[model samples]
Target: MASDGASNNERLLAAARDDNEDLLLDVFDQPGTFDINYQDGLGNTALHYAVLHTSYDVLDHILSHEECDVDPTNKLDKATPLHLAVEKEDPEDREYFVENLLEAGANYTIRNKHGETAEDLVKPGDEVILALFRKAQADADANMDDIAYEDDDDVASEGSD
Candidate 1:
C-alpha cells in the first residue's frame, strides 16, 4: 500500500512536469491514488514541478483544484511555486506564470530559505512584474479592510441588542 501511494505520487509529479493533462485527470479520478499536495523526496509538490517545467495547463488545473495549496515550499530552496515563476528565463512566460500564480492566491510575501520573497526575485527595472505584485498587495489590503468593516458592523449591532 505504501509503494502504491509512492508510485501514485511519482505519477502525479510526472504528469505535472510533462504537462500530461490526460494523465493528471486520470490520477484525479482514482480514489486514494494520490494526495494533491504530496511532496516528493525533495519536498517538492506537484505544484512546484508544474512551475519549474512551465506546465501552464497542468498548473492551472492544480491551482483550480480545491485541494491545491498555492504556496507550498520545497525543502532544498524553501521556494514556493511563486519563486519558480519569478525565475522563468523567458519574459513573457515569467509574466504569465506570475500573473496566474498571483491570481490563484500565491503569496508574494513568502520568504524562501534565503529570506527572499518572490517580489525580491523580480528583475531590476521590470516594472511590469512589480506592478502586478503591488496590485495583489493592494487587493489583499482592501479585502482586510472590508472584513474589518463587517466585523465593526457586527459589534455595533450587538451593542444595540
Candidate 2:
C-alpha cells in the first residue's frame, strides 16, 4: 500500500514535470492519490515541478485544485513555487507565472533558505515583475486592513447587543 502510494506520488510529480495534463488528470481521479502538498526526497512538491517545467495550462490545473499549495518550499533551496516562477528565463513567461501564482495566493513575503523573497529573485531591469510583487503586497495589506476593520465592527456590534 505504501509503495503504491509512493508510485502514484511519483507519477504526479512526473506529470507536472512533463506537462502531461492528461496524466495529471488521471492521477487526480484515482483514489488515495498523493496529497496535493506531497514532497519528494528533495522536498519538491507537484506545485514546484509545475512552476519549473509546465506551461500555463498544467500549472493552471494544479493551481485550480482545491488542495494545491501555491507556496510549498523545497529542501535544497527552500524555494517556493513563486521563487521558481521568478526565475523563468523568458520575461513574458516569468510575468505570467508570477501573476498566476500571486492570484492563487502565493505569499510574496516568503523567504527561501538564502533569505531571498520572490521579489528578491526578480531579474535586474525587470521592473514589471517587481511591480507585480509590490502590487500583490499592497493588495494583501489592504485585505488585512479590511479584515481588521470588520473584526472591530463585529466587536462593537457585540458590545452594543
Best by TM-score: 1
Q: What is candidate 1's lDDT per residue for 63-155, written digit by digit as tens?
A: 888988999999999999999999999988899999999999998989999999999999999888999999999999999999999999999
Instruction: Please list the residue runs of candidate 1 whose C-alpha ends up more than 4 Å from where it truly belongs after superposition.
Output: 1-6
TM-score, candidate number 1: 0.93
Model 2 quality (TM-score): 0.91
Give the alpha-carbon lDDT of every model: 0.89, 0.86
The global Cα lDDT (0 to 1) of model 1 is 0.89
Q: Estimate each model's TM-score.
A: 0.93, 0.91
Instruction: Extract clashing residue pairs from model 2.
Output: none
Give the distance in Å from residue 96's predicted Cα in candidate 1 to where it truly belongs. Answer: 1.1
Model 2 lDDT-worst window of ten? 1-10
Among all candidates shown, the one with the greatest lDDT: 1
